[model samples]
Target: MPPADIDIERATTDDLEAVADAWVRLARNQANHGSHVLADPNRETMLATLGAYQVDGGLLVARDRETVVGFASVTVERGSLALDCTRGLLSNLYVEPEYRGRGIGTALLEAAEDELRGRGVDICTLEAMAENESARRFYRQAGYDSFRIGFERTL
Candidate 1:
């Protein structure tokens, strides 16, 4: 599908369920790339999170005509008082599997950034699984670089 066909707009209360569904799919995909999340078990939590995002006007949906094809959720992250900049966190981004590579994800991401910028956010941050090379590459192409890296261990 052409990029022009996808419409990126703020998500409404009516979109919460669809956004949660997309989030679940995103979690399932991440699980294959080293994420430990349990998607199905977290449906209610995801719904609540989506509601919060909606309340903050940080939930965006990408629609191809009347059908929602993807969503991006963002939030302002204020660190300790010692931090230099308030960051806009791209908390979640996902496009339907069939919509991948059609520029929908990029549209959603850019829309998210614009939403943040409108709120006076000059910096942004997001996390992708270490093993998800495709996601890393996409972020790099979008002009993002890693300023922090995390390591985890299981006892």
Candidate 2:
């Protein structure tokens, strides 16, 4: 649970497989926080997508010794509005259940934000499951606030 227990670093191409696997787990976790059936991502497609953005942004990983315990996908994206504002999307941030209480998540998040800032992003946005109170609390503590509400229904 201590901040010094892990090291945060930018993931390299060699970490492709691990990043993909972690992404799958993060999708499952989000689904668990809400009522929904989340489909598995196509590994090949996901890998290419994550890999493609390496030049602009990247996957930041939290490592315990040589083992990766958590990761976050940071990317630059255009804001929804027509205005020309640079937006950084915190696409995914995941910490294994066993390491949830540690400072790993916070470290990865801060690192991702710092990376975005370095890239000239004017603002960064992240979303949490509407019903995941703890996640909401965590994001709030991480300097995020709610500005939009999304509605969805199973078809």
Candidate 3:
């Protein structure tokens, strides 16, 4: 599908529930790699996180008409040891499975870059699980280069 038909906009407070639902879906897809998964988030926590994103002002969503096809979150933060501190983090990016490969992800990433650049963010960064080769390729094609190795050991 052509991306021109899709409408992309910043998410509002009213979108909190939808955003939370999307987050949960994406999280479930993540590897269990020794992290606790909460089945439900209380209203207060959900509202607080979504509210914080709204205040930070960088959540963007792509909608095919009224249905949100994909969403991404961008934020400027002090980068960790490997990432550049001057860059904006592409914190979260996900598309509904049905919407994959239709340019929704591309549009979302472009939107994120626009928002980050508007804020004087000269660089952008994101991380994907090493096991997710598709995600790594997607990021690489989107102009991200791998610069650091991530390591973890269970104690």
Candidate 4:
């Protein structure tokens, strides 16, 4: 599959539950790629979060005639009272393993970026699992350059 045929759109309220389910699968996929796992991710919580985000951000989904192939979650980062919201962050962009080569991820990402740009965002930022080489390559091809290094240790 090429990168020109995926159907991407903004998720509506009716798609809430389904989007929450997709978010869980995304977390699991990240875990599979050696990232941290959500031991008990709550669907209700995800729905509520996304619901609120629907007002402040935009949730995008990619589908192939009904089945959700992927989704992207984006929000304009609100700065302090002294600053403005000119930065957007793509918090998550996930595609199913089976749909990885079908252009779905690219579509979702592009849609989110466009959504942010429409809101006057000057820069878009996203974080990929350090262990997920595929994700790194994807963002790189999407024109993102590394600007930070994250570190942590068990306490």
Query: lDDT scores for all predictions?
Result: 0.90, 0.80, 0.78, 0.80
lDDT of 4 by residue, 1-155 (tens): 22555678877787777788888887777787767768246667888988877656588878777776788889988866545447899987878788887677877888898999999898998998888898999999989999998987889
TM-score for candidate 2, residues paired by index: 0.86
Query: In model 1, what lDDT does residue 29 have?
Result: 92
Candidate 4: pairs in clash: none
Task: Order the candidate numbers by TM-score, best to worst.
Answer: 1, 4, 2, 3
Alpha-carbon runs more than 4 Å astray in model 2 = 35-41, 79-81
Among all candidates shown, the one with the greatest lDDT: 1
C-alpha lDDT of candidate 1 relative to the true structure: 0.90
Specify the poorest-scoring 10-residue window by lDDT in model 2.
Answer: 35-44
Question: lDDT, candidate 3, residue 151?
Answer: 85
TM-score for each of the candidates: 0.95, 0.86, 0.85, 0.87
Model 2 RMSD in angstroms: 2.4
Error of 1 at 134 (Å): 0.4
- How big is the positional error of residue 92 in model 3, measured in Å on the Cα after superposition? 0.1
lDDT, residue 60, candidate 4: 83
Candidate 1 wrong stretches, greater than 4 Å: none
Best by TM-score: 1
